[model samples]
Target: MWKMKPSIALSVHFTVLLLTLSSRGSSPAGKETFSWVTLPATANLTWTPCFDTFQCTKLALPLQYSDPEAGEAQIALIMSPSNYSSNDPNYLGSVLFNPGGPGGSGVSFVQELGPYFRAVIGPQYDLIGFDPRGIGQSTPVLSLFKSPPEALEFYSTYPQNVNESISSFGRFYAQANILGKLAVDRYPTIAESVSTAAVATDMLNIAKALGQDKVNYWGVSYGSILGATFAAMFPDNVGRFIIDGVFNSHQWYQGDWSSSLLDTDDALTAVYDACVEAGPSLCALHDKSSDLIRARVNKLIDSLHVAPLAVYDDSDPSNISFGVADYTVIVLQIFQMLYTPFASGQVIFEALAALEQGNASAIWQGSVTMANDVDLATCNFNASQPFVVGFLDISAPIACGDIIADEDRVRTSDEAKSDYQRMADASSTFATTWYPLSEGRCAQWPIKAKDAFNGSFTQNTSTPILLITNTHDPVTPMVGALNMSSGFTGSIVLQQNSTGHTSLSGFSTCTAEAIHAYFANGTLPAVGTLCQTDTRIFENPSNSSGYTGVTITPLKRSAEDYSLGEAARALAGSNFLAKSAGFFGRRW
Candidate 1:
């Protein structure tokens, strides 16, 4: 959501990088000047130091690309510099990044983990992240309720989850329909402008502002979908792009995300195996065999399904408060923890073990949240619930608006049930709890995108992109990378032999080397290349955590030699997933 402004041209030659647009015709014989950062004078793109170590900038882009006159929207951008000036021989260029929440905030992402990402990709190019249109820090925020009280009222009375009980499925389905209608009713203008295609164009504009014709990018999960869309829409503009944790564009644009979780169950199997290898001392859920452990865990969850556990604080004479730890609430935490198993194995197992012993504090404390359950009795009426931002405001529109919606979508209870069952059949592990990520997300979506691309993803870019995927991603699996790579001829699939969401979720020296080599000099690994991650999951560290009671290891390595696994653990405090915090934990 930005309006383009007229700016100076950039020469792609290594000799003279930055140039003026007026002198384009009289430039030196062989140099080709490209029109970059053509922003209006009112919206000049300028950088300033922010967050102590990073450079921050905001660009005004056309609210609607198709109609430049449709006012403008502000895009918040943050960049971690490569520490090399343009004249320095070490300065390559800039790598534009999208952490992938079709609705994720780049400003917050860069603020939190820019150093880690810049270190991983190499120090020659600047790493940049942005909050997509109508997202965090960006103008025209998309939200259903303006304040905390409204959201609290809705969530408090809403179906806790679709899987809370047999009847909850129907209530949750109706609630989603109501939410879609409410969102569109609240923000139709944003709903029309927020799509993957629009974000792709925004990336091109960002690349131009950075004085580069080709965009150097690293996108994860939903970000991968954004990268693929960029390559397909503007093939010649592609520059050393990497789509890690591949989300099949074919599956996404079709309004069908059922196929993406094909490897979630397999990821769980790996987690269980690693637990057995770690022994009972390190892993709380250890068993002689994976099957035995699975049965044990399933039995606990089954019991919760029949009778939910209630946690009550009756210490105060007059005030007794309670919170319920049900099947859906605990499973949602399990499904999210599975995203980074190396870091969450003990967190999950420990909570489960505590629950098995008839204590719900561990799991309930980590999972189901209350605004002020204990203090509700004495709670001031004027005081509101803690305002926690949710991403569904943007994710719903991107997922629902991008697709073609008919009169017969997720409007009815039967349609929602059928869609959910389809997802469960594809991957039974966390389908019920994780259903909000994709399936039933478009229930009664009221608005349609002004511009949507449900076409082929085939592209022949000037520079080929590198596609990376974990062997067993909880959401976007290996098949997605293969399917995405098929359209881009000459593109190579770099497989990281790791269990988690993406290559960053685990530590792999080989994968790091390949990433470094690729960005440093457009180097491509051999066809059928497989990199093994060095992460040792389910291993207890020296110190236990104050929060989860699991042993926690602190990561403080320099960017030059950082471990992706350790970095991931450090980043657990922030929601690294680009889409909804529903799966990844936090909004940013």
Candidate 2:
């Protein structure tokens, strides 16, 4: 409903855009000075260029903003400039970005996707990414287990065996115990400061250090939550921000573990339905019908729950072994693969076909191969079982700090177990494994963040944010975006009638273009806007390009059947969600 002033119009040219701060005078004139801090904008800061194409910088922020003068910590950042320099009329300032995993290295994100971002969003604004406190490259680098072997041991000890039945609670409980003890030992006081609020403040500080008056952000998945927090805290400092693959802050911090995961199950179901449509000639496990293919996959899951299948293990001199714990891990892998159906559809079909033909070793071997993003040796699955210690070491604390805990309500292990059963009954496909995994890690997380905000989320920012989400995202659902929109008054939503973890890429050329337009010129798509998904799950390039509204079988119950409080309780009973191999089919 609101538009940028004519003075700040895209075509308007200015000889100079001065952005400065002083402890004495009011904010400087122009659209570039932030007067929020009482001191000169440039405080303790340093920047250096590294890797030939990027600038690396560190800001010494107070360890605890509440006690700023008490202690300080270093926050690391990496910057990739636009094609146009500040001296050029084409320069559009900086758009700070966060790539989802609350613990995901922002430095790595910029270094890895700098060129792609510049191409998609336009090479006018500099792309800046900063590692939040307690995360990668930042000081107090939340290292859970120092070495690769130690990290392996932490995962190996939990849920001890790969062949253990899914019904067995011993493995999950064991996992919770180790996670809880390890988090306390590793992070201690520092973990308390890792909440989303703290990270939001870090973003503001980074913007000020970079000499930007307002904040410009692009965050995906969990990063969406961080973006929202920033907009809320620095409403007047709002720039153009996009929260893609929107995550529901309420569901994330509170509970309703089942609700958040419901869409993932649907996404998985979509993959099966697509495979069936492709037919056995094209799909390896495509039997006679789609229903039959789904039934077959469910049967495999059941069988694994009954007994772990034998698989090759290079760690064993005999070269053969089976651990029950690996079954859930492998299933999780399958879930991740399902995210990019068009890209990895055939590979998934082949993997399922191998399983149908009784080749269990090949499946685990496949997982090892796909998850090799690193040196391959880094996440060596040659051991007795496989596991990955991902961004969770930092993600857990930040997430735990944000949500209101249900621990006191549960009171005992038996109550927690009962609650888990209730969740499984509601939707076993999404809940059974994921609910337990996420809860296990969080329940054991020791500290409650003193700075985390769980109060009213309303805010009147200078400019409203643009929220986007795929119709069927695997991790953060469409419902999340819908719900999150209500909290931010005046915010607009763009529903990409597609399916995936995020709304960009080949999935929807339309969605990508819409995002590009907003960044290039601050124009929001009209209310109730829905962009058609140009690429179908298994559709080839020559096929018709448009949204197919092909409804994957909906969840049995209406979402309204459960309340947020109920969902929160469900989440409270669980701990850490299982970690994924960084990328699909690539384990580094």
Candidate 3:
């Protein structure tokens, strides 16, 4: 039982704060010099001041990194200065922070939580956040879809029945094809297109523009993938890089959706078990330890598949019944909310109890539609879902296909479906559904993959990268972290025994302290060293001090059995197991 101080004791450290503009290298002896080129910032670039008192600067970079001589893209760069800037001589470098979501805006995220960084990292380093290319403040952002309600309608209407699912798949594919064709006709992938590689280059260019030779980066969720890729590409330019919610670049490129889904499922089960073990004193769903929470939860999920529950609209009084898929989406959203216990736990437990009571408004309120405001024209697709599906669907055909003749093309649709089904059967129950959902969207989208996906991490470089992962993260599971650790030779792994998506700012005092020390001193934790987190810091709604209602649940045997049973039923009669057994059997 690892016990630490309560949440309030987690104070924001504000000592030794300093901020200084970078100057040109005077002598060039053990110093680097970068010519400062201050171009006109974009007009559309917007700035919302830091909520906790900080200054923000909007910067512009080329939309396409490869062709800097081409058109420009505007990015919002927010800088939170140290309190003691005038006194300190050795000013720590600017620590760029990214809260993931190739779509998530760093400017707003850090502006809101700037004080938290100041408290944890102290006042030495200036915390800077910039919206990545194709994201907020970055020009020509990816705003393809309509409102959240519209997006939900699109997603919810997806056919769950075999015949409808297949028809829906075709419709989606047609739409994507149309969209892709339009995109290609309108703007070809020139040297300056917005790609992950391009984003890495932009980071380096941003550092150079800021008049800094090396940068300290703190990237969460999707930001982890960006950070790792940047490190892989520009190793020497990395001063201190912390990548939380590890994204396996190999698995990502290879399209290993089934594996990723399994990982997520396992993490969720762990949460469920933890909640059960915490008992009635803590968790609302409290029952006897042997009461089998996972079984009950599964039963509730199955029941929804048949009858569903009508949840009252948060905004309106109208009640709406939700299907199993809707419930699944709610579960995914709750997984993220787990990071903020107080805000999520009560909501999750209440929703669960509601499901038991034939109501589901709590779940609906916290569903993806509500939480992400997904219907917004600015954001239609969730960032992680596409990546997961794309990887698995694209990788199998490429990995197992005859590459010489079919170099660029994937396996035939039928073949790919069969392969996916087989993989799902052998892996997890949700794989069948998840695999299709993940890849199905791409079927309609017109752009063909550049090449057969390969599970290879381009790691010939000598970059000192630091990889941080939570042992029980629901999104980018621990297995993904392990896969990343195995791939990046120069990378250091910091395994925090925490739950949720990111770990750097979301873990216990010791973990957070170690992260601060590493960023501040450029030191890496010992390999295989595990940082214990304070699991007691749940999201307690009753307690005004903590987040609304988030709680941690451990994975237990009953949950595993339930999940396994669900998988077996979902992948019944598909050749899924025969093909996937090779990969999934290793888990046993």
Compared with the true structure, the alpha-carbon lDDT of candidate 3 equals 0.48
Judging by TM-score against the true structure, name the best candidate.
1
Q: All candidates' lDDT scores?
A: 0.66, 0.58, 0.48
- Local accuracy of candidate 1 as per-residue lDDT tens digits, 1-588: 110011101100000110111121122235342211221222656876554466666788888888787668778777888878977999888887766656656565565567667666777988887878876556655666554455555555455457766677776677777777786677788778888888888888987877778888888778888889888899988989898889888877767877767888888888889888888877888899999988988888889889989876666769654578778666766766666666555666777777888876556653424422211223322232222235455677887887766555445667667777888887765777656546566766767777676556888888988999888888888999999999997899999888877776676778877887899899999999998866567666312442241222223544666564444444432324412233211131
Model 3: which ten-residue window has the lowest total lDDT?
Answer: 11-20
lDDT of 3 by residue, 461-491 (tens): 3446777777765446677777776666667
TM-score of each: 0.84, 0.77, 0.70
Q: Name the weakest run of 10 consecutive residues (lDDT summed) in model 1.
A: 6-15
lDDT of 2 at 495: 89
Ranking according to lDDT, highest score first = 1, 2, 3
**What is the Cα-based lDDT of residue 206 in candidate 3?**
71
The stretch of ten residues in a row with the least summed lDDT in candidate 2 is 10-19
Q: Which candidate model has the greater TM-score, 1 or 3?
A: 1
